[model samples]
Target: MTANDRTKSTGSTDRTGSTSSAGTPGRPLTGRRPLAIVAAAAALAATALTATPAQARPAHASPPTALYTPPANPDAGRQILDLVRHRKLADAAGVLAMTATPQAVWYGGGTPDEVRASVRQTVVDAARHHALPVLALYDIPGRDCSQYSAGGAADTPQYEAWIDAVRAGIGSLPATVVLEPDSLALLPSDCGQDDARGSRTAERYTEIHYAVDALEPLAGTKVYLDAGHSGWHSVNDIVPRLLAGGVGDATGFFLNVSNYRSDSELAWYGKLISSCLSYVSAGGAAADCPNQWWAVNDAQAWLDAHVHAAPSAMKHFVTDTSRNGQGPWTPPSGVYSDPQDWCNPPGRGTGARPTLDTGDPLADAELWVKIPGESDGQCTRGTPGPNDPERGYQDPPAGKWFPQQALELVHNADPRLVP
Candidate 1:
């Protein structure tokens, strides 16, 4: 997901902000609201005994399967604890609830042993809290295509080994794995990816297919391959990539992973993708399926006319709502050579909190795949310099938490943070 960067496209979404139904009735975006610290610990213990994952798990991890639970000691959790120790009410800060839940633990740019250790440490940590972990696998052969977050396995063999290590670390525990973002969307055939005869792109598919084979069979792990987001590709265009990269055996494909499209838009996009896939599976033409660019009424009516799959038969999906509170940024006219709006966008806030009850059956959950505080690399917006003039400061390197940006997100959160 390259730190959840939105594609470089202008659309109706650019004018209107995100429309989230996180706190709406029947949504129940989180397990519970703020409770006393002692009460929360008791609740956690009670949850472990009774909670069950949305899906069953295999014979691995102690007690086998448990529902996704929040670690009581996530960094943000600890930060809130420290605040409370000083008579502050950071616990009252809704960000605490968001931080307490399961989030994707990204593994990239590390040696096999290092990756194993990191993955093991993360899963073990989450297990202590009875929470399932969402692991993002991004160390593919040509990750990020030499862009801001560029770095991946040197070759396919190394990539396969990396996946093996991740699986070993998982060790029969439940996991939601987001495999390789942008690999399918921005293939070698597109843009700067210039592998001759498209061999690199072919290898990319091979690597992803190999990843699917290696990880999909693990006990209760739900593997969601990437389909970018609604703003990036038409459902028909990405459907081929998902199939080529092996989505049939996967739990489903994720949309807007680490990207900031609206929750409502993502829900619609995901439903359309699932319908189109079902349509194609039923011997229908991919060209006939309407995509995100299609008018809403026309697309829904078309699906009604042709799509025969029930909601249960359709593949499920998850959306990244980490920082889409205000949706995409629209820069001033001619502000720079390129207004890299997604890069460290000035005022984006955190979206819905992580939860299982997303109110939509097809949506297994609305996850926070992109960590809120992390910077999206040094965004020059087309000007070449270490400092991004757009923000008037040198942004942190990609994957590093930006305190200033973190504070911004906390302040601008959709539900609004109290502390």
Candidate 2:
């Protein structure tokens, strides 16, 4: 509900990694054979293509890099194990297909020493595989607006020490770090949790800036700040936050983490934000930037006329396609007082597989920022009862796996997970 709950559900939890032997850091880990076949098909297709005029839009500007694939979550593993025990080999294979794809490893709460040890082991394991790991760092103070996926450090100093431990664990390993998913979008001031003096909001920014400063400086770590998603913050609204949160120094910002925004929407929005960031850095006003709310042609025209920075000159972004295969869920009008659309909506499927080959210059990758099949917390839908009326059952907490949801994601996967 709060721009993709990054923390493990109220109490749920999830790991580390090392450098290249994995090929190149962040490269797609969908197996070398599959990649080769796809490349051959693409090459064959390219031979028959006709030339077209270059439009003023974001195009693939960088070669694709590799992304690490951490082990599947316990739920996925358990599901597979049970299926195997029952001789449900086909079903077991199907679930394996769902979990085999590259996804982020989330880390929310842990003691400094514990986190450091865990992260160190993770990076080391990644190094052994010759892959690059994606880390979802989500232990900020006042996280999740203190909702279902609540809990973070008690205060700023404690938060800083935790971050310091994370840095120590990462060391000089090649990694892609997605810093605090909702850190920017759901500030204390916006949640009515800040004081009259806005001390909490100020502290939030300070924490974010501290993280960017700390993690971005590591030789092999590329740190990305949170910018919510296309549906939440407009280019104008989030650009200033990114700037304030140290996007200038970090590896740009990430979009759609743990949310369900479509690929096309995310691409367009990311381009606009990247272009606007450039425009603002060049002395243009944030309000003057073209926004996603504008008509498509109008926005494109605005960009052509006002922004001139190359993709290489602007900050790059990544998107969460983890569970947006069917786009957003639209509950029946006037059904429940609150639809809780973002909270474990039914029939939603996994989107694109994690890949650095996004083909859009501004989009660095389409990542599974939210592990597939993880619950978004129990949804009451404004009812007094504990069960979600939509599902007629109590949903699992934020980070726990739901077997039904897992199969739903597989069955409805946009490109078909098992075929």
Candidate 3:
């Protein structure tokens, strides 16, 4: 969910309150964490089955499913609208709706009652407008590994309580939940997380399974598990993570949530992963699946030959086209030890506008999961100083808007945002 990821500053008023945290930095890694919890995974399933939501769905409720709809005017959309109104950014005015397209309502951090009140109000407002509510269920324990986006629920029980509040908040209404963006992508073990016998990662999967089982069963909710992105994980690599994290129980999984990767690549990568999943489900070894490192043509050819399941049997997926139109940034070669290419790469532009009308049969939608103009973090890129080498000034702490980047995204929009 990051372009890459760190440090210093009283971060967002949300959780950790720190903008930077220790990390491997630069390109993402699968880390040295062993997924040796096969036995524990089965046990996690048992726990999930017995688990209950923070707020239980009413036993009797036949509410109609909710569909996504954009408000004619968005409450948070004013951030960008104000930019246009005051700055006379006439050329980029039409792009206001892109910002207003109702990305997600982050549960950031709060007590259960407070969370319930806020979430209930968000859903109520969206329902009033017939718009689908996109809730980011963030606040899980060990969130962000104490990194820039740090701060989730303190522990499993606390998380469950918060989740219960979330469920209670939604009540009988329909919603789309971007369940914990990096939960699966960056597991505790990856960040040297310590627990008993691969227990931390196991708990994460358990927590995810719990949420999926709870949310997916609701009458009007779709839960999309995290798949990181095409650039991050191989099809074979991620399929296991997905399966382990309960993708079957989800409406589908999400890709490139807050990173930059071309739609063509993301779509192709998604198809391969989905196909590989079907292959494995039918008893093929995960190792037999084609991966991102394979040549594009060969990958497609592999899927054509091996995946036997009909399209409907395979899981569906969504892509975050938030800021990938220009793809990722490339630094001049031999510049530094690490080039965190994903974090706030300069010159990136907005990709396709958010829409549910993706023509691909398996793609459920293309969404703006990452709020456009938001900073990935203070992208030092290993130069070791306040200012980003890519951009002269030190960028703001993560999640805050980067006005120059935002303007660049609007100006260089691929199809060009026209209202």
Candidate 4:
């Protein structure tokens, strides 16, 4: 299915009165007095004032020379704006703060010329502010196991043409392209979406390889392939896939793109994957490299004994802090046959702000690869009914603005999204 097809199938009106589309989307923090919450909300409202939208910058005024802030999807700011109009300043502040932070712009469906024009506009906009835009190229064939957010190019040829268009749109401009989330982690074979001949899986690899080759050589482009998250795909399992998909040719891999794994877990997972990739490149077997499940001391010790490459020599990675502040959710045991913990779990919050100055050597930067306020599709939580059993309401479809979850993310933001 293409993005339009998915949108047509699952499209519905979100709380903000917008039609849902194909995309990745997110919850809140915990204990606090009512007064403290109110005061923090006010502080956040004040902070939003300082985060001027990218377009507001004068043609020559140098904005923060950092991650590119794309134009707001109406859903992103609508909740905040509505709350502000209602004099719900506290709630408005939370939503404002969430939207104010820079997030990645996703492109999953378009004709070659259409995608080219769209991408060109984004890159040009970023160039105006001297910012590096994070572009997520998600139109791989057979994406998302045909589940929520299921959509991509119809086939390899079309996909390649789309990539060429993206490259043309980029045109030697600086950008960090997150190439095809889940393209590697959730292959067609993994979801039984492939045939006996495994043609789809082979094509999947070919497509990703093509994307890496197409985008990595750009003069100012840095491309990162997806590696799922710490919660899934051990270092051994993911390393081989990354290798197959040409991680060596790309900038590196990204972890927790649209999941809720904690920062500590993701960092350790990234380090292990980086170390293992280095070890493999040096003729060490991936199976021999310690995985994330190993005890910390033992894993480090294994790397010490088997991997001598400096951190600079290893593959670097970025993590999604978009909605990991509260980490992964744990549903009540024995309640649902499938928890769908990743799909719009309640009480999650935004993670660390996007930044390239990560102190870790092998970790390139932390990014909000997933938009913070969009829905992860309607999370049924194993029920036959439409409503999520846990939340008692039908969640918005993927890529739609989810106002309740947006507020939760604000309230629960780790490091506290306060003034």
Candidate 5:
């Protein structure tokens, strides 16, 4: 489905002030607290009761396959899996306890050594819990169109060196990297006013190639290049960008990183891009190609026809399930005060967490590329300071925190939060 076509669950809301709840008479519904707390508490109680029955059963009463085996990093997968599986919060939490870490941090903004040291500590801690630390790379030049999401590496050269240091931090450990979000699709031939740097298409490709080339060789590092989302660009438009930006060298591409595009849309978009890549490898030109807007019935049909299961043959795709439960909120007429509505638009809700298994051969894995707690930049309605509730600053743009955004996200996801 197109992003606009994806259905919004019954009680979803836009966090931005433009929308209000249906009931509760005049009070400008600030948030969705009462209902979310009730849901979570009920879920927790049900989860405890369900475990009692399971514990009484024989150790191997059910075949290993029938049992719900949590992942080695259950915390990383829980929220998303629970949402996907339609399980109550408590049950998902039970599975999550198996491998949840305290908090997480990304290494950027400091000297290479400092960044490396900090990241190494985080990685080491995650390894201790046998969890895969989710790392987000957000130091690309011209990040967030150089607005509030600005403040990346001073230059491309420094950015590359920073990437090198971050890689060293990972240091042959089990980790997943969501590389330079919005760096691919959001980049334009011209970024307003900052024309001096120009479009680093060639440089961008080199950096992406370098990151993939550097990380994938590591024993347990899985690096995914960020592909914006289904709404931003058509597969045909983006596939060439991927190829130009070193999709050939990376482990694969990631879709819906930090955006609210649905699984069906993501799967279809991913398959289309992958298929186009296949066609290109066989000498098809990206330009002059028709069928740019080819439609599919759903993700399954798209995958069956286009997904190449083998990672090496068909470059795989990973999707971000961070905050996309309800696709995107399109402003009525001219509701946006800022043109950058793409940055944390109001009324949006959290989506599933990141995952490695999508049950589709074409889809290599799904992941929470967007760190939930981190701000998508300053919102038009919220304040811009640190953790400012009015501004909604859960985590600094690219910093670190433990169990960040989960509580607030769960709150936001409640239908009661929506107008």
Candidate 6:
């Protein structure tokens, strides 16, 4: 059944004033606090101003040569501009930092306040340099489908407040906010089996709608709701969820935020949903939406014929390029032993440099939604220490690198790393 049908049939209440608590389930170190504290401490240290003679500089020091310039393509440039304007300087920095070797920095770990401040400052700095900023919002409750990185605001209310702080931080700035990754499609509403399903469903809608309501209206900000990879949810299944979660308010929906689905696959999936959305908005039954089953040989051609350069009403989408160059890894046998592939699958390498150009009119921008180099989470593979093979622990999941894995990719890409 369509998500809308499911919602209506379930008789879920309207999520008007529902709110979540600040506390999240799981370990204390799991959420954004540790990172926030670290950032706060760093800010404090930077402010002390008791620098060594060499570190001190004149207030009038010339701004560093505009470190980043938006790419020539409008879509790509717009993504860059959004990042710069919104104060995502470090993210902006990643566009260049990974030029030599593919890498990116994920920035949501810090405290809500500190992260908000850092993003604000980053935008201010980027504006000074005539650049744009791109921001990624990944803290959806039950994030990562409630896996290792699975902590979020205790409930929806707290999440709304946290989102408000983030929105306030971007006050009056031009930015692109890639809303909660995998929050829409990868939700656990269905995972709870018999008893827990009801509450999980309510929580999912509450959080999604709250986020859209809070972020979509921010001036100069474009919020793209996350749609899972092409392989996951069908168009019929995802579109209604988008609607319930306020897709109408969002700029558009984002696809393949952190997964390895190919551009061709993502484009197809995106267009399919976009069409379904058009039908739904027109008062058509989502279940009867035949567009969902349409076949196509070329995603670009399909998009070319049907998709708009930008949606008539909503904002638009932005995708990630953090680690999809080679697509998904298929294990010869049991890879994760339990569906751990979502964490940090083996043999995967970095993808294209994060850019905004999707080469399709309907696609708003392409970005590095996944911050490369950050740990996805600990896994069972190689040694525990920095890619040490003797320990046989693997790299942390997702953006992290197992030194050995990194070396393999580097050597494969350019024989230099193999000495």
Q: For candidate 4, give the lDDT.
A: 0.75
Q: Would you estimate the TM-scores of all the predictions?
A: 0.81, 0.84, 0.80, 0.86, 0.65, 0.66
The whole-model lDDT of each prediction reads 0.68, 0.73, 0.66, 0.75, 0.52, 0.50
Give the Å error, residue 273, model 4.
Answer: 0.4
What are the C-alpha RMSDs, in order, of all predicted structures?
7.5, 11.3, 13.6, 6.5, 10.4, 13.3
lDDT measured at residue 78 in model 1 versus the true structure, 0 to 100: 44
Residue 61 accuracy (lDDT) in model 5: 20
Model 6, C-alpha of 54: deviation from truth (Å): 18
lDDT of candidate 5 over 214-295, digit per residue (tens):
7777876777776667766666677887887777877778876656776777877776677777767767765533232554
CA-RMSD of model 5: 10.4
Instruction: Provide the lowest-lDDT 10-residue window in model 1.
Output: 11-20
Comparing 4 and 5 by lDDT, which wins? 4
Task: Indicate which candidate wins on lDDT.
Answer: 4
| lDDT, candidate 4, 1-419, per-residue tens | 11211111122111111111121132223344434544544455454444334342223334335888775556555555456555565566566666767888888888999999889888877877778889988888777777777778899999999999999998877789888877777788877888999999999989999999999999888899878777777789889999999999998998777777889998999999998898899888898889889999999888888888888878899888888888877779999876766777777888899998899999888998777777777767668969888777787777777777777777778967765
Superposed Cα deviation of residue 9, candidate 4 (Å): 25
Stretches > 4 Å off in candidate 6: 1-112, 193-197, 290-294, 297-315, 333-339, 380-391, 397-402, 408-419
Best by TM-score: 4
TM-score of model 5 (CA atoms): 0.65
Better of 1 and 4 by TM-score: 4
Q: What does candidate 1's lDDT look like per residue over 1-419, in tens digits?
A: 36347454521011101111111111112334434643453444344345433333223445423334433323344444444443333332444544444556677768888887777766665566566677878787666666667778998888888988888888766678888766777676665566668888888889998889988998858888888787778888888888889888888888776567788888999998888888888888778889998999999899999998888888888887878887767778887877666677777778887776788978987877777666677666678876777666677677654555655666667967443
- Model 2 sits at a Cα RMSD from the real structure of 11.3
RMSD of 4: 6.5
Candidate 6 per-residue lDDT over residues 282-374, each given as its tens digit: 676566543334667553455455444445553355666545666664534643233333334445545655455557766876665554333
